[model samples]
Target: MSQEVRGVIARGKGAPVEVATIVVPDPGPGEAVVRVQACGVCHTDLHYREGGINDDFPFLLGHEAAGIVEQVGAGVTDVEPGDFVVLNWRAVCGNCRACRRGKPWYCFATHNAAQKMTLTDGTELSPALGIGAFVEKTLVHAGQCTKVDPAARPAAVGLLGCGVMAGLGAAVNTGGVTRGDSVAVIGCGGVGDGAVAGAALAGATTIIAVDTDPRKLEWAKGFGATHTVNARETDPVEAIRELTGGHGADVVIEAVGRPETWQQAFYARDLAGTVVLVGVPTPEMKMPDLPLLDVFGRGGALKSSWYGDCLPSRDFPMLTSLYLQGRLDLDAFVSEEIGLDQVEDAFGKMHHGDVLRSVVIF
Candidate 1:
């Protein structure tokens, strides 16, 4: 049976998100219906509202979420009703070229619910990141539901569904940050702080956090940054280099998707060090000029992380365990708890950098 639930939707470009009645269908084969318990307010939600992601108007926003499986469809043995799960965007197709190569993290084909969630008048709505989780209940592929420790707080661990996971994976998976490595993360938002925390978890000796916002820099410290650089006052590349014994960091993770930040990340790494771009850039953005020789001279891996190269099946459970054990401070990321109607206001606070994440609690 189809169910009607309250959900946040972006009706048009630059439109203020509205709480609308979304019709969610029963799970089809390989699908599941989740009763969302908590959903994080991510910048991507705002991007969708601004039409920065695509021309798909009337988008059902909110992807970073944690919930309980309410129902499962045929052939869905991976999850069942009553299971606590963190919703993920990447539901890898095992036969994809990347998956066949044993890198499911790079799986080109991911899964979403075969059915669409629509509005009352029967207008189809595009779910943000393939998981329109802001609703009271949502339909998604069974593989999108990764069961985690039930004891973990939904508002905190739900962040692993998106931004937090992206940052951590940027450092640990993409950058290959390791023990004693010098790592610098540009952009001290939730994603950058996750990189900081991941670097710490990886035992990186020096974790340098670079950000223009002083408050964000302070937040970075809580995530285990060894040093903070105010990029607005100092050249980030030079500061990062100076902090790393004037040799640059072993890995530079760019969480801000701007061209200037990318260049800073490029110049902030040591020779043969890794540079991971985890930030989402706007469609109109372009890279600045760089000499071809410089790229060769740098002699390091320049990789773009799609969803932090995270394998939700593996990372979500492990990260949630760490969070439950208090090893990962996932709770620090939630600055406020809100209701469904406050999503638009949360976007404003996020735009002003007032909070790391304003999670909606059901």
Candidate 2:
């Protein structure tokens, strides 16, 4: 039987999302219904509302989430009812060429629930990032649910579902910010701060956070940034080099996703240093024009981190454990908690940089 529940959806472009009656069906084979406990209001949800992602209207907008498994369909042996799990969009297909090459993190084909949840009027709803989590209950592919420590805080660990994971993975897994390295992160939002934290976790001795907002710069400090550069007040590239004793940072992560910021990241690194682009850019946005020589001259890697090149099964559990050990401060990323009705308002706060993350708590 299909059950009626409340969920937030974007009915049209630039329209304010509303709490509507959603008809969720029973899990089909290889699918599971999750009783959403906590879901973070990520910026991607706002993009879906703005029609930035696609023309798919009535998008079920919420992805960064955690929940308890309420039911699992046949062949869903990886997770079962009563398990606490964090949902991820990257449900890797082990047979993809990327996985065949031993890099499942770059899985070419990810999994999403085959069945569609619909509005009461029978309008098919598109789940945001394939996880549509702003509802009381949601259906997802079994592989999308990764079990974690049940005792962990849902609101905190749930962040691994998106932004936080992207930023942290950009630094550790993609940029390879290891011990004694000097790192710089641009755009100190939830994702940038995650990079700062990841650099710290990996023992980067000098971590510099660059952002237009002084408040965000300060937040970066709490995540173990050794220095903060307000881009509005100074030339960030020059400042980064100055702070590193006339040598640029060993690794620079661009979390802003703008070409201008990418240019800044490109120039702010030491010679042959890595530059990781973790920020999501609009489809129309193009790269800054750089001389072909510059690309060739920069002897190191220039990589784009998709979900920080993370393997959910390998990373979700480990990061959750670190959070449990008090070594990773996931709670610091959550600025406030709001009800589902407040999601629209949270989008406003996010636009004005008022909060790091406003999570929806069930």
TM-scores for candidates 1 onward, in order: 0.99, 0.99
lDDT of each: 0.95, 0.95
Poorest lDDT segment (10 consecutive residues) of candidate 1: 283-292
Q: List the residue pairs that clash in candidate 1.
A: none
Candidate 1's TM-score = 0.99
Residue 360 C-alpha lDDT in model 2: 99
Model 1 misplacement above 4 A: none
Cα RMSD of all models vs. native, in order, equals: 0.7, 0.7
The total of clashing pairs for model 1 equals 0
Model 2 per-residue lDDT tens digits across residues 51-143: 889998989999999999999998999999999999999999899999999999999999999999999889999999999999999999999
TM-score quality measure for candidate 2: 0.99
